[model samples]
Target: MDIHRFFPPHEGISLSDLSGLCGAELADPSQVDRKVTGIGSLSQAGEGEVTFAVSAKNLPDLAKCRAAAVFVTEKMAEHVPSDVAALIVAAPQSAFARAAAILVPDALKPLSFTSDTGISGAATIDPSARLEDGVVVEANAVIAAGVEIGAGSVIAAGAAIGPGTRIGRDCHIGHAATVQHALLGNNVVIHPGARIGQDGFGYVPGPRGLEKVPQIGRVIIQDQVEIGSGTTIDRGALDDTVIGEGTKIDNLVQIAHNVRIGRHCVIVAQVGIAGSATLGNGVMIGGAAGINGHVTIGDGAQIAALSGVAGDVPPGVRWGGQPARPMRGFLQDAAAANARAFGKKERKRGGED
Candidate 1:
């Protein structure tokens, strides 16, 4: 598809005209006639493109930029070269987004079924699963026998859905990503290699070594939650393993049974949360961070990369290191290592030098 055709030449508006769009007063009306095609970064902008300077630090790059026009704050107006046309807005970055929309119009296609697709005649589907124009549903990609899927939700070969799994619009279920007996909110993406709703890791030590415990719970994923490739979420041992709304689970993330995560949390790649671990809202667990079983992380807590969290974390704290204390405490311990060497140096200088 031709992108230029989508954004066919409309009478180009200028920086002075942009002020009304973004609620900014233009410093100079005479400099508004420069024609702008689209928006680009300061480093990559060329003729016919417009760029922005967000702060004083970005002013130097904006000055040397070769774009047709540049968006600048009131304070950075002096740094704009005489040859360049300035958009001159209080919030230049916001103006850039608005301007880019005008220049780059969306080319959305109508939804339809293609000739190269396959569908199972016996598969039951809800009336709301809107398949887009080019979507391919393989044989037996059960649409959950009430699942309203948006355009382009591809169900791979041999994938089955449990009843009442409401998949929102535009979700891609990889080949055999087992989603059963749960509700998947809108725009929730699951990778191909993931195994969802499997039995949890529960066992009781018996006379020999251990005895297996039954996992009889569901995995509830909210809107915009992405399960990475090869990642797995176990079914709850008793209750559900609830992934909070807008939370992102990275590749290879292992969320054990009955783990409750809060909204908008970031669980990075290779991070493992044992059974029944609870993370509060807006929590960020860095890459390779490990949380032990049954611990609760309070709201807005941040775990640094590769940290091992054995105990509970309080609210609004940044934790790092092995045991994962506050960031300040970890830095202090790192600084004190040099103090120990300094103490040995002072003792040797005083006596056994």
Candidate 2:
């Protein structure tokens, strides 16, 4: 497919300009004026487009590429077609990513889902709600009393902003999302179906039954944080649950009460962080990892997919396993366990002998 039919193509950026934008060098100055209007994969890119090749495996594809320009390292530069402009860079993929930001800027953030220029007539805005000049409240959205939304923010269709909530400028609350008892910073993005500021799973055994504890705390999402679709962040029990600036949480994640996630952390999809868990800056958690309650993951640590974290993770290390531990020990244990279960026969992935 033609993605241009859906996302549309950029007007055009010359190869000379793209080299500077991507921090790459224009090796062939003669073809510097060649324009790139879009980007595609190695096998799929056509005329007036750009792509990148990072390794030897891409040589075959590079030879057949018909794009206007391609980003490559010096070693791979010879494989690029003579007709195609070669933008040489230390990291081809990184250069391509930079180019994508400039080329497909609309894909970076959600735009207006409807034709709404301002607050739609069908939206329910309370008399006490305060919206900035450029705020766009889409159809069927509900703005409760005392809610304050900043300029350039978009409350998409069916979103609900509860009373007294404060949203900063240039934020986007997605379709069908709910925000209550929360304070969102500038440039925050909550994708469609995200549930924010909900009650934590807190209860106590009473004489009659389990009694719900008062969830009086709020969620504080700092600037540039992006919560993915279907993610749920529970409100704190007493203290605020804070997401630091530039942290990106993927879809289907569950962040429980009192969680404090640090700046620039990357939490992958389906991860479950229990109550009171703290993650330090630059910590990267892979998909489906389960973090136990009250645990702390230190800065620059990485957790593998499907791992289970029991306690504190030290700074600047990698951990993986059912009960997560250092990678060295975890790998040894895994090999032994696998041998015992599978008759000590080494096999490739998918059990191929």
Which residue pairs overlap in candidate 2's backbone?
A: none
Q: After superposition, how far is residue 110 of candidate 1 from its true place, in Å?
A: 18
Local distance difference test scores for all models: 0.76, 0.94
Best by TM-score: 2
lDDT string for model 1 (39-127, tens) is 67887777777778888789668768888777788788788777777667778888878777777644221122233254546445656
If scored against the real structure, what TM-score would every candidate get?
Answer: 0.68, 0.94
TM-score of structure candidate 1: 0.68
Model 2 reaches what TM-score against the true structure?
0.94
Looking at model 1, report the run of 10 residues with the lowest lDDT sum: 107-116
Model 1 has an lDDT value of: 0.76
RMSD of 1: 6.2
